[model samples]
Target chain A: NAGVTQTPKFRILKIGQSMTLQCAQDMNHNYMYWYRQDPGMGLKLIYYSVGAGITDKGEVPNGYNVSRSTTEDFPLRLELAAPSQTSVYFCASRLGQGARNTEAFFGQGTRLTVV
Target chain B: AQSVSQHNHHVILSEAASLELGCNYSYGGTVNLFWYVQYPGQHLQLLLKYFSGDPLVKGIKGFEAEFIKSKFSFNLRKPSVQWSDTAEYFCAQGAGSYQLTFGKGTKLSVIP
Candidate 1:
């Protein structure tokens, strides 16, 4: 089972160019999240979805948008990319039982570069 | 405002040496703690987790973490080091909310 898969292992975009990072999970997890990892920095949450049709902002949600139209897919959109947005992005998901202790499974990560 | 802090930015150790990485969180309520490891060119994977029960939780790869609630610290340690253990370690906290807050991470380089 592909726990979580992210597309475009690498990407480069202009300052104003827009792109979407695709993430999908086959585990039917009710919880999904997007995070950016910077050099010497821990992963920072950008956005997350509790379930289909439910999305919310995370610690660092600026310059980004997300939608969860289905239980299996959560895509992140960068409308106007900036150099500050360049970093490795990771997609994660977990089964949401009453106890929210489920381990989050992460994707291979998308290395984005803004020129 | 919740935050996680990792004391060490980078650590180098020789094989068979003892290991310890410090992690602390600033959350006043109940929280779930976790340790995630990322080897070179590999995706992040769970090393261990602490929900409730024993304060000392054992994880894979001979790693273990102790949760000191009073101090709001969850420190990772291993009895022996191996060259294959070279990786980045992140300490995260799960609050009442489902989202997790991760620390800057400690890069562990185990020299052979």
Candidate 2:
């Protein structure tokens, strides 16, 4: 069902360059999130959206921005790329609130390299 | 701020060996716990989760996790490990908020 899809599986960015990491879900999930995974650092939250037109910052939202214009899309934008931003970024989504045995679904992850 | 800690960074075991990965969280309020596994070159997938009911939760691939509220820990365990069980395991906790806090993750290598 293409639970969640992320574009540009791999990319190399120059310092100070800007780019957007596109994420989309077809499951009509109300919760969408962006996280960066670093070695031995697990996944750090970047930004999240509860629903359309509702977005919020996460644990590590510096140098990044996000928007939720629709229920199916939540894109993360990096204004100025830095070497510290080189990591694997994952996009995830969940059905709704409440524990209810619902688990988040993650994307294939985008490997970004800032040089 | 909420945080998660995985005691073991990396573990290696032979096939048929018992497996246990320790996970602890810092939040004291009601929380939903989860275990996620990521195979080499593959996306992360749910291994198990604990919300309520029995403290022991069983998940796919013959995995199970015990939630010890007193200790603030949700540890993953498997009776017998298989070579295919080798993967990176992540522990996460979701509180009243929609965002989840994740542990650093533990990498397990099962030798056949």
Cα lDDT tens digits, model 2, A4-102, are 999989999999999999999999989999999999889999998888999999889999999999999999999999999999999999986553346
Candidate 2 lDDT over residue span B1-28, tens digit each = 8899999999999999999999999999
C-alpha RMSD (angstroms) for model 1? 1.0
TM-score, candidate number 2: 0.97
Candidate 2 lDDT (Cα, whole model)?
A: 0.93
TM-score of each: 0.97, 0.97
Give lDDT: candidate 2, residue B50: 91
Candidate 1, superposed: residue stretches over 4 Å from native:
none
